[model samples]
Target: MRRLGDLEAEIMDRLWTWDRPATVREIVDDLNRTRPLAYTTVMTVADILHRKGMLRREKSGRAWSYRPACTREAYSAALMRDVLGESPNPGGALAHLVEQLTPEELAALRSALDSVDRGAPGDGPR
Candidate 1:
């Protein structure tokens, strides 16, 4: 998937944070508090996101309500997968990633790996 533009990322961040479908007006109002943005601009960018399959929208009254097509965690995981795919040695890249993890994160990773090794239900493959 293509990376989002600045405005697109900002809009997506808002949608993810809101955790609910939102109309153009609602997004524009919230964003305008941080930086001046026209409603038309926000609406146009939202339509672009929908076209890119990054957002899903439904008609609400006279307007469209939009929400993320995927959750933030899913999107982040995809980005990480993309980066890993680009490495000359994916295993080494993953090792480098592990080296950088915080203690809590490392513990969580260990627990997940252990679950996978034990063939735990709902854990799936690592």
Candidate 2:
């Protein structure tokens, strides 16, 4: 998956955190609580995200309501997949990643792998 820009990320963050469809105005209002941003800018970026297949939008009265097309976890997994796919030493890279994990995280990874092998869902990473 393609990485998001600052504005694209900021917009997606709000939509994912809210876990619901929201208008560009709603996102702009929430973002404005901390920083000054133009509504048109957000609207344009939201449209861009929609075009990128990162967001799904529908007409809501006079405005468009947007939501993330994939879950945050799904996005992270895609990034990880992209990294591993591009690496010349994928196994070595994965081993290095595993070496950096905490004991708890390692256990979670083991459990998730085992669950997958068993065709069941495990408690996700911590």
Candidate 3:
């Protein structure tokens, strides 16, 4: 997946957190509460995200409604995989990531691995 720009990340964050489809106008209004942003600018970024397959869009009256194509966790996992793939020492990189994890996170990772080992779902890692 292509990395999101500042605006794209902000929009995706809202969609993921809201867990619902939203129009550009709604997003622009929400964003304006924290920072000034134009409706057209957000519409353009949302279109880009749709083109990148990061977001799904549909017509909502005269406007387009957008939602993330994948869950945040899935998107994050793909990003991690991409980073690891780019590393010359993927194992070392992974080890370094593990080393940085908190105790609870480490335990969750271990549990997720164990679950995978048992042919169970790997939902415990996150």
lDDT of each: 0.85, 0.82, 0.83
Q: lDDT per residue, candidate 2, 1-126, as tens digits?
A: 232378898888889999999999899999899989989888888989999999998999999999999999998998767655545355564443433467899888777677664644644444
Q: Poorest 10 consecutive residues of model 1 by lDDT?
A: 91-100
Q: Clash number for every model?
A: 0, 0, 0
TM-scores for all candidates: the values are 0.64, 0.64, 0.63
Better of 2 and 3 by lDDT: 3
- How much does candidate 2 score in TM-score? 0.64
Question: What order do candidates take by TM-score, descending?
Answer: 1, 2, 3
lDDT of 1 by residue, 6-125 (tens): 889999999999899999999999989988999998899999999999999999999999999999999889877666555534555444343346789977877878756576666654
Error of 1 at 2 (Å): 14
- In TM-score terms, candidate 3 sits at 0.63
TM-score of model 1 vs. true structure: 0.64
Candidate 2: pairs in clash: none
- Clash number for model 2? 0
> How would you order the candidates by lDDT, starting with the best?
1, 3, 2
Model 2 misplaced regions, further than 4 Å: 1-4, 85-126
Clashing residue pairs in candidate 3 (N, C-alpha, C atoms within 3 angstroms): none
